[model samples]
Target: MFKVLMIEDDALIGDMVKMFLKEEGFIVTRKTNGADGIEALSRFNPDLILLDWVLPDMDGLSVCREIRRVSQVPIMIVSMKNKVAERVDALVAGADDFMSKPFSMHELIARANALIRRSKLSIGTDADFNAPTLSVSAIAAAPVSAMKPAASVEVPAEEKIRLDVNTRSMRVHGKHVDTTYSEFEIMKCFVNHPGRVYSREDLLQTVRGIDSFVTERAIDVHIANLRKKIEDNPKEPKWIRTVWGVGYKFIPM
Candidate 1:
């Protein structure tokens, strides 16, 4: 069972979340303030942390930063601030994910499970594990060896961009393109959807997960980075194009 540390001052909210998490089979340790939260960290040895943005003794961002300085125990921030900038700020301060206030308990539990799964993968504890929530594109792109020959269709000739899930690598125009995890997820969103126009909001939820609250500007930055690696002319992007009023789409030429 995964252990979770929740630092939230609202007694009602704390109890509510704790009860639900316990039902999910997580061992939860609740603390009301930053000092207590910090103190509980070592004692609890939590697999993940559910931290609130506002606390009695101090802001949670500081606590998050402090924790990251010592450990990579996944930190998911809970905040009333839902603005894109505020969400980005939390992420920059060392949060692994963010949940806006009035969040559904169902989504919260699902996100926690994902974080724990990936955390285990990162620590070499679950290398063969893939979170089941990933889209169909992920399963379809797995190594040919993993799929039956009849189901392992050949890559389309018109599709210039390709992904190898077995290697977690991508290729554009027959050249390998290196990617960060965020950029890779963004690419996956496009590859999976084809002509579908995804809003910035859609990408955030799909690429980062439902619990993630992030700036649309963060998406733009990632797109820019991805273009530099894949596009022959970053100014005239070929694979990823801005949808003008909309978000972005992946168009393989």
Candidate 2:
């Protein structure tokens, strides 16, 4: 069974989530504050974490950063604050995904399972794992080999972008570019199929899970952040280009 550490202060929410996840065969440990959550990290060694924005001790963002310093376990922040900037802040703080309160318990479980699957894929340790079938629109569980690197795709010899799936890292022009999990997922989808137009909703589905609370415009923010890192001049981006009314696509150099 996969272990999950959920750091949420609300007794009702925490109990509800625990009950549902338990039914799904997950071994869930619930903590009411960020400090206890962090303390349990070493002991529990959970495969995934579900965090709350308003913890009694510290905020979810701080707990997220603290966990990132020690482990790469996938984290999904559950919060009542659903603003685009707030969502982006959670992602920037090293969260792998985010979920807003008042969300359906069904969607939360699906997203949680998806994160665990993705984490196993990134580490190449999912040869024998079997994920449950989920009936979600945007956050449906992906195929086993859905995250294959773009190395298999034929690109030009002058291509400057490289992705290391094992390390979950991206490099541009022979230099390493720091990418959050969200940025990496977007780039992974882009490079695997160069020039394929992905609408904001499409990218949102790619980064966040089924029926995510993040606004489509937040995709614009993630794209801008990527442009600043990989593009020589973000003002006139060369790699990722906007399709105006449509969305964005990757243009290999």
Candidate 3:
């Protein structure tokens, strides 16, 4: 079973979350202050952490930064701050995912499970580890004639996407991009429908496979991190572009 540490000041909220997590089969240890949360890190050694922005002793962002200085364990910020800038700040401080208050229990569970899966993969514990290997001979070999199309209808594959959904892995321009499952799903949606504008509400519904409980601003945070990893220049993104008042879209190459 995966162990989770929750750093939340509100007793009611912390108890509710702990109950749900226990029911989901996770061993949860709760802390009500940021300082205690950081100290619990060494004792709990949890697989993941669920943190709140406001704490009694210290701000959660400071705790996140300090913990990240020592470990790569996934951290998810569960806060009431719904601003895009706040979410981006949390991500920049080393959080792996961000969720606003009043989030769906189902979505929360899905995100937690995704973090666990990603942690396992990063630790090389996956059963299916068929990452492609490149060789000099294979690169130098001459190309053969193109194979016949599988279907006569000739449905063109979406452009600028090189992800293997079966393996939960993705590559952009020959470089592997590491991302959590939620991030991967969001990116895949854009890649599958290039040049199609999607509002934050639309994206939350489609990508997260749920209702739009999360704020539109949260989408910006995920997009910012996505661009930092996938784009050569995040300040001027190539694949994902903002559409002023409408929303955002993927510009296929």
Candidate 4:
């Protein structure tokens, strides 16, 4: 079973979330304060974390940053702060995903499952198998010899784009890039359609998977982070270029 560490101060909300997750077959551990939350990290060794933005002892962002210093586990921020800036801050602080207050339980479950699926794929595990030639009974069942040498494969000279949607992971220009779940979704959208100039509203709706709780500036922030990871110099980006008064486009380089 997948283990989840949930740091929530509100008892009712905590219990509700925990119960729901447990019903979904996840091992849920709850902590009421940031200090205890951080302390539980080592003991739980959780596969994922559901962190609240405001905790009694410490802010969730700081906890996220500290945890990221030592671990790469997926973190989903459950916060009431719905501002675009706050969301960007959470992402910058190392949260893999974010959910605003009063969110649907279904949406929360979907996001959590997405993170877990992506995490499994990042470790080279195939969660789904459809190939007739390959039987994936387990992640361990896939032989290393059957894997393709992706690093050595020559990306087309036109523009190189790499994506592993299952993991929400990406690499550009031969360098591994760290991205939040939303940012990865945005990048994946652009990579799938290079040279397309997408308006901020379009990108926000497409990447966020919902039309609510996002702003144009939020899209800009995600683009900036993507540039930092994919560009040789963020100040003068080549892959994702600005469109002056318009929006942004992937230059496919």
User: What TM-score number comes out for model 2?
Assistant: 0.71
Number of the top TM-score candidate: 2
Clashes of 4: 0
Question: How far in Å is the alpha carbon of 203 misplaced in model 1?
Answer: 10
Name model 3 segments beyond 4 Å from true: 130-253
lDDT (C-alpha, whole model) for all candidates: 0.74, 0.77, 0.72, 0.73
By TM-score rank, best first, the candidates go 2, 4, 1, 3
Candidate 4 achieves a global lDDT of 0.73
- Each candidate's TM vs. the true structure? 0.57, 0.71, 0.56, 0.66
Candidate 3 residue lDDT tens string, 118-237: 666644466354432221122123232322112122112432346554444667665666665456667756655556798887876643422223456657777887899888899999
Q: In model 3, what is the error at residue 81, expressed in angstroms?
A: 0.4
Clashing pairs in 3: none
- Number of the top lDDT candidate: 2
Q: What is the Cα-based lDDT of residue 33 in candidate 4?
A: 90
RMSD of each: 8.0, 7.5, 8.3, 7.8
Residue 194 in model 2: shift from native, Å? 3.3
- Tell me which of candidates 3 and 4 scores higher on lDDT: 4
State how far residue 173 of model 2 sits from its true place (Å).
4.5
Report the lDDT of model 4 for residue 199: 87
